[model samples]
Target: MMRRLYQSLMAASRAHAQWEIETTTNIIKNRKMLIILLLMALPLIIPAMVHAASLPEAIGGKAAYGPSYFSAKMFYGSIAIGVVAGLVTGCIGAGGGFLITPALMSLGVKGILSVGTDMFHIFAKAIMGTTLHKKMGNVNVGLAVAFLVGSGLGVTGGGIINRALYNYNPVMSDFTISMIYAVLLGFLGFFALSDYFKVRKSELSKNKIGLEKLTPMAERMQSVNLAPMIQFDEKIVPGGRKISGVFVAISGAITGLLAAILGVGGGFVTFPMFVYGLGISTYTTVGTDILQIIFTAGYGAIAQYALYGYIFYTLAMGCLLGSLLGVQIGAITTKVVSQSKIKAFYAIAILAGFINRIFALPEKLSQMGYISLTPSTGAILTNIGVWVFFGLVAIFAVWIIGTFIVNVPNLRAEYDEGSKAEYNAEYGEDNKAVVSTKRGAAQ
Candidate 1:
């Protein structure tokens, strides 16, 4: 079950990577659109630049910072963090968004602020990057509509909870978020590590690429003939599968709540819910997941976080720019690396994030007087977690970059040959003749 979940998560991550590439390309191509976006952000950008100095409280270290504080280093730091997260998503094929909140909290950003900012980042990326018309064929109109209905409600509830907690006590807000991340990361991280070892053992025995069976839960869910049955998978399956719209809505609600609280945009959960929970085909799941991501992220960011002053525009933009570049590099790197190795790295990255969050918990607990530990000890634990997490992340980045650099020649050759093959296949003799004629003229 965990292995299947891992596969589902990987598939979703690839879709997200592709989406980012396409969206980034579109944003770059449309000059007017870019200008309009820049103009809209002018107010925030100017203020951030004008006050681009380190604060003792806000920035920490020699620099201090707060929720509203925006310094040059903070902006640049967000970009750096974005790049690392993108690398993880691209290279490992999932779990990139998981790092953002933990990373932000590690950097001393309030939990609410971090979650809100990440949500906005996802939203901004989605709106700018999404090309719905192309994906419309794979989308189930009924499923999407129903899911959004529930997602809206879920987002609203999640936002209210977060805001209420934040308003009640900022420390409580931080502690709540930390504990949530700690539990989640710990579960996923440990499971992933175990999966990695299992795969390694299987590979040694020359047994790999085994077929996946549907989970018992999925079979049971599809077996029940619930009302308002939504039909789907006409293109893939014989006739189709039907599950109650209620099930779909419930899944969406869970996804939306997570998105609002965690700022992951719900892509991670949506794929698994559609594929494993509801027995939907992967073909249909991908498109629907994309739609869910845009809506859930957008609504949560704007209604929940941005409206409440939790978002940081500079950080969002920085992360956006950095992730765009990092994702492309990481995606291409996959071509050069082995699958088993990639899986191992993914497990490591997740575990690192898990450690980072868990370690930071002590400090928050101590601050709130829930734990009887000295501030220095709490700080020490937090610092250790930070170093371990960032150190592992930095190592992964360097390895990828180093590998990419070393293999660029081979990659370039492959690209050139592939392009030529495609060109010949498309144009055939006419293009060849035209090229020959051009060459003769030049000669």
Candidate 2:
């Protein structure tokens, strides 16, 4: 089950990465869209510059890092964070967005701010990238409507909870977020590490991979004949299947709640839930997930976070900029790197985040008076975790960049050779028409 879950999550991550690439490329190409984004951002950035809050003023806590104002330092630092996250997603192909919130907290940004900022960044990307007409054929309108109905409710509830906690005590809010991250990261990290070893062993033994089996729960859910059923998978499956609308909505609620709180767009679990929980076909699930993610992230970020002033616009933009470059480079680098090394690095990166979150928890607890540890001791442990997490990520980034640099010549040669082969295959080796067309275009 853990292995299956890991595979589902990885699949979802790949989908999200593809969306990022497409949207970012379009944003670059469409100057009108780029101008609109910049225009929208200026309002947020200019106001923030004039009315930036100090740490204490923002959160009613001690100003540990001084005023929480925008600066070049913060901008560049956020860019670096985004770059590492994008590299992880592009190269390792899973669990990259998991780093953003934790990394932000380590940099002294409040947890709520981190979560909200990440959500906004995702929302912006989704809006720019959405090409709904192409995907409409695979999307079940009824099913999507039901899910969004539940998701909207869930987002409202989650937003209220986060705000209430912040109102009660900022430290308490940070503590809650930290604890949630620690538990989640720890669970996923262990499973990822186990998967790495399994893959390594399989490679050494030269074993063939097998298809995934469906769980009994999925079969049972699909068989349920409850009223108001949502029908789907008509194009692929013979006659398709029907499941209760209540079931689908409940799944959406759960996904939306998590997205609202964690700012992950809930993509991590949507694929698994649709396929394993509701027994939906992967073909239908992919299209639905994409549509749902756009709505979920946008609604959560705008109605919940942005309205509440939890978003950091400058940081979000910086992250977006950095991630675009990082993802392009990382995706290209994947051609040269070994699969085993990528898997190993993915495990290490997740564990590093888990360690960082878990270690930081003690300090938050101390601040909230839930523990009796000395401040200095807690700070030391927190710093250690922060350094460890960032150091591992930085090292990984350096290695990826270095590998790309070292193998540029070889990569270029392979690309040219592949292009030539493709052209030859298409036009034949002695096709003068194709040669003339290429020359004409160049001229």
Judge candidate 1 at residue 44 and give its lDDT: 55
- Local accuracy by lDDT, each model: 0.79, 0.79
Candidate 1: 10-residue stretch with minimal lDDT: 203-212
| Tens-digit lDDT track of model 2 for 151-242 | 88888778888888887887788788888888878877887778678767453213422212346777798788887798887876779778
Q: What is the lDDT of residue 194 in candidate 1?
A: 80
Runs off by more than 4 Å, candidate 2: 28-71, 131-133, 201-214, 423-443
lDDT of 1 by residue, 247-360 (tens): 999999998998888878787778778777777877787788888888988899998888878897778887887777677778889999887887778778888988998888
RMSD (Å) per prediction: 4.1, 4.4
Candidate 1 is scored at a TM of 0.87
